[model samples]
Target chain A: MDINWQFIISTLPLYQKAAWITIKLGFWGTLLSLVIGLVCSIILYFRIKVLKELVEIYVELSRNTPLLIQLFFLYFGLTKLGITMSETTCAIIGLAFLGGSYMSEAFRSGIEAVSKTQIESGLSIGLSQMQLIRYVILPQAFAVTMPSLAANCIFLFKETSIVGAIAIAELMHVTQDVIGMYYQTFESLFMLVAAYLIIILPLSFLLTWLERKVRYAEFGN
Target chain B: MQNLGINVLFEGTTLQRLFEGLMMTAGIAFISIIIGSFLGIGMGLLRTSKSRIVQFICRLYLEVFRIIPILVWLFIVYFGVTNALDIHLDGEVVAVIVFSLWGAAEMGDIVRGALESLPKHQVESGKAIGLSFWGLYRYVLIPQAVRRMLPGAINLSTRMVKTTSLVVMIGVIDVVKVGQQIIERSIIKVPTASFWVYGLIFILYFIICYPLSKLSKKLEAKWEN
Candidate 1:
């Protein structure tokens, strides 16, 4: 079959709009996940009593299930209970729910890697607890966390594709729409792949660069 | 309006249909894992080859999978390639092909990491014993790498299982799709059927994945020493 350039060109506007929606979902999802991750990691790191166990359970539940089922439950399941949310809200919440667990694990590992000696040294140098966290602990932990954080960011962005199942017109949803309408399956699929590559490939490279730039001085070559 | 909360699950043929769907999901994951493991081992071995060109090709294969979502790959194969080639392929077959390719790429990296992590001394010792290259790999290298590959392999299997849920999108009547069908049929009699149906699916996935993840963790802890 011949490639249909005209069909692709005609659908370019729809693709652009869908791409923008995907970007918005990814952006909000990433931001919310980062916040939830940071908060949960801090709670677990300090071993907050009941909350620690609760966060652990939440992380396990979120991570063990697929994002697709989670979206279904959030979007379809909750509506029956009168807990209604927009499709966008459901998508963002589902992404964050999955991403938060992975991110917290990354953060937790980063925090654990900052040896006790560094914190002690900061304390001995007459630094207050807050000062020690800001000046010493935060820098080392952030450096170690950058690589995994970047990876989680990519994972979450790709996961936004699943949101299409809930009727959100993200990239995959629109591709399906076009395919079903005009039977231009090849062209539509080509555009779908191109859209993902355009978005993810650059982010991946930039993240790798950022990870390298943030490497702690002591983590030598 | 009739209120059927958890009872929606027990409606006619609902449980049985879900059971069949669950089997399909498991079957797909199991077949892909087996095929993917064999192919991944080969790819992993090549990744460690001395030739730069072979390494570059393997890296390219790995990155292509990593860079694109599995959902897009599904569409490209099931909808795009089949139409372009004028071939009729079953949705489950398409899902298996796509997932096996993905699983192989992930498993290849795990195998490569396990093989490379073996100390350089292991190889030198094998060489000193008059063992040929293949002999060293067979007798010394692969045996040790198998242990190191176990936890990672189990983890990847769990990941593959969870990811197989996406197969429903390509029209494979997996568990999620079955649940959606049940909800659509029962919506009038049980307006809350979706909640019960989807909630059960969530639990079903958890039941399948939770133990695999726990076992992976257990093995990692046991083998760490």
Candidate 2:
């Protein structure tokens, strides 16, 4: 019946430490996924013969299955193949693979959004394939995909909580541990919610701003 | 192959247990999606309401649910709130409630987008015909909105199905949880149990979700046409 503000306040330091870990996981996860997604999208855009189908299958499998199961497969199934990694490494890799699938879809759409005429024009100017991609395709695609990329980043941030299931000592994991020690379930969860909102809300605002800026740059204010 | 031992999947009770878990997963996702659609429609209409206070409340609901991860929300309901209130609800009940809450927020956004995208003159024409607010929505708005909203709502349904896998964290005995248990129990007897068990779980989810996602894409393309 009684709420404990004092207890919640006192636990802020512990939660803050966990929050830092979450942010780190999210940062590295998003970065890794973004690179993977970019490569996959570029490969698909160029229509690489054999690897294209393989990449499509990878994306479909990751997209279709649950992240938890994917995490489990990497964490548990990999052990059968004699591949061992720490919980944190597995969590980061799992998140990257999961986020990469979605990111590749977003980037594919972005690349497709670039007009065919642009590439043709670049070719007519004697541009190499690489030059055409660098000069004519990627910039515009980056602008088009920025919003979705930002949204994916936020999704990855929230997904860091799932790492807790694998005992990665992320935000949710630490909060659960704190609850086990003190039994302040309500207070701890309330603080956890606040911690996530604090990170996400500002990130969302920044994304919106960046989206607008990109739009303006593309079209003029 | 010899080192892996005989497959235990088709052995006595293992298949039945996995089937039950699969059914539980389907049942929870189905119930939550249906219930969440209704709640979402209500919230979505509220979001587009003319009243400022109603709109603010709707925005608050969407923002809070969207910001927090569903796992955290599930934990709050299953562990935190229940503990505080001294209620002993079943894990399935908690999963349904948590998933429904998530589905509603997502579907509400879909509905709001669909409704808002309508031409303003359609509503003006309804008002010009001297129709009441209820008549306007029933006769003028909802019919068109439903068509536009179908693909998005279905997409949300697919997402809910995938997201429900998190219920294993709360001990829901869903397919993932069952797989976890099977692997844990079979480790001594079959060293490769986790590979088969988790692989089967992945396939089960892929079967359920891949078709729905494909259907969603088809519906989206159809609508686009």
Candidate 3:
């Protein structure tokens, strides 16, 4: 194979920095998605008639639309409204929003998995609504959400590559820039693939760790 | 651009644009299912093979295909992976290849699930009737398994159509890309109504996918009966 060992060696540090950006966006995106999703899913779990329908519509619309369109729309549309920032932040925010929408459904399903009997049990305790959810409910729901959230994290990590279109200095963006500068298009992209592997392979192991730790009746061993 | 009532839906050449994209989308969706189904059946059975090595390969195929997001997969196949493999191919060809692999994995799992859902008694009776393996599958097993698999397979097909939009990221110019291009054009010509273009896209996707989603749900209910 015709390889460029020298170029990769020289750019390894730059790639490392880019990797940091990728990791940060993915981690933050997953966090935001989980938090926001969990909050919105309360309406769905409570089955609050009109609110449930509205959240369902929100979830479906978000799921059906592609992340890229949403990114571009928010990017350009917000800029026109005088909201501007570094492209990296904008891209990460977009990733978070998109991932958050999907995460809502995940949380909703997880909450529903908690069994209505648990709700009756909580009511039997005569605890306040807020106290019941805090003490009796959310812990079990979060446990069930682990395996799914793992799969989603890996996907979100790869999705950071889309930010390259908007010229963020992440791995994929640097990849394209490197190719353009050196004209070693294939080599640059191959390096990016290897870069992705280095980034994701560790996270995959971590996911397995979390999933195993959660080890409940519902999820896999 | 033409205007009709308060509903800007069917007006201007928007209907024509949507029609063209809808046909392409449906054409790809239907064709991919036909292709993915056969491949999925083979892979699904291959996964159930007694040989450990064959099972390992099936698992590896599913893992790699599943872990990577479809958009990234499309980019790599159409651009990076193809370049590395040194195979020159068009965007659509690459899209179909990647999508088929994805569809195959999902379909294979669905096939496996449906096959497993069947009771052992039915198979035992087929064997008691002195039917051969192929005879049992062709006459008894496949029909019932196919019924159970229909809803999921159709749902996956609808998903395949929705996912065809990812082809646009690699520059295939499907409905989404065409919408983006039109929006850009409209931005220059008529800056007053950008929402119209996005709303058009949302409607177009609905027109294409909503019916499929409903049909799949209906098929599921019917199959259950």
Candidate 4:
């Protein structure tokens, strides 16, 4: 296939702009899930009966269903219920919700990775439970969770592109828009793939570094 | 529309609907696994290649597929390539292509893990026995590696089945779409309730997915012995 160099370059600016939106969506969605997943994990870990049960049902339900359905139920179904918002908001919420389910599982495993005996020892030192968790338990759990957490971050980054289905001006959506406008479909899409790689590959490298650093500091069991 | 006893799912057009949906879901899944397994094995070998360039390329492929969301992949194959070619592809065929791409990346990782887990002595012994590379892989190395890989393959195959539901976004009319269609139509036919139809769809998915997940687990355990 003859490569049309100028067509691909001209399309680069459009994809670059779209890449920013994908990054923005990933950042906000991951931030929301970080909080929700942490809280849900804490509640579940503590054996808080009502909260734990609620988290269990939520996790199971969300994880089992396709994220597309979850997005549809949230974006389309909720709009019918008079819950209106911008496309960006819908994308962020759906992504965060799905990520939260997976993140909760990741968090739970991390907590389990932290030995119970260590937690008991911290408590037996007469420290309050809060101090025990903050000082002893969470640090180790967080370190253990770094690799999987990074993987999840990358996952959410890719998922943000799915918002294009609902017409958010994310990377994939904007690429499609350009393709439609220009009709240089091959060039536009090749640029899209290149655009995605630039953002995502760097993040993957960053995560690998972070994972190694965490492992070195904590010395994982 | 006739209810035989306690809302018989397998009755008349409803029976046909359920069967068709189930068939489509299974069809997409089987197609993905068959295509994906070959691609996966190819990618996995690429990943473990001694050549740094091939290894780097495989890593690039793995990273792109691993990180990118499945829906986005679905959109790309279903929307991007098809639109580029200006050809209207069948939803099921497109779904298979999309999922096989995803599944192959995942399967490559699994096979790589199995290969890595193998003892060095096993390979050494094969080479020491004067077997050619192909003969060694065929007769000795692969037999054992395949056993290690099967459970993980089973796990991913189940995921591939459930993931066919996502193809509904492109209007494949899989069970998920069928349910959505029924739910939408039910508003006029049975104005009293529509959530029930959607709820039924949800349960059908759970019924299919949960059992397969359990089977994957069972295979993992049985093979561990």
* Best candidate according to lDDT: 1
User: Cα miss at A212, model 3 (Å)?
Assistant: 2.1
Candidate RMSDs in Å, in order, are: 1.6, 1.9, 3.8, 4.3
DockQ of each: 0.85, 0.80, 0.28, 0.27
Runs of candidate 1 with Cα error greater than 4 angstroms are: A126-129, A217-221, B1-4
Off by over 4 Å in 2: A1-6, B2-6
List, residue by residue over A97-197, the lDDT tens digit for candidate 2: 99999899999998888888887989999999999888878888889888899889999999998988888877889887988899988888888888998
| Cα TM-score per model | 0.97, 0.95, 0.85, 0.82
Worst 10-residue lDDT window for candidate 2 chain A reads A212-221
Off by over 4 Å in 3: A77-86, A216-221, B1-15, B18-22, B80-87, B192-194, B214-225
Candidate 2 lDDT, B101-140, residue by residue in tens: 8888888899999999999999999999999999999999
Poorly placed runs, candidate 4 (over 4 Å):
A1-17, A81-86, A180-182, B1-19, B67-88, B125-151, B169-171, B179-200, B217-225
User: Candidate 3 lDDT, tens digit per residue, B143-193?
Assistant: 999989888887787668767766765666577666666656566554423
Candidate lDDT values, in order: 0.91, 0.87, 0.73, 0.77
Candidate 4: tens digits of C-alpha lDDT, residues B86-146: 7888888888888888888889998898888889998899899999988987888778889
Docking class of 3: acceptable
> Residue B164 in candidate 1 has what lDDT?
94
Tell me the TM-score of chain B in each candidate: 0.97, 0.95, 0.87, 0.89
The window of 10 residues in a row where model 1 chain A has the poorest summed lDDT is A212-221
> Which candidate number maximizes DockQ?
1
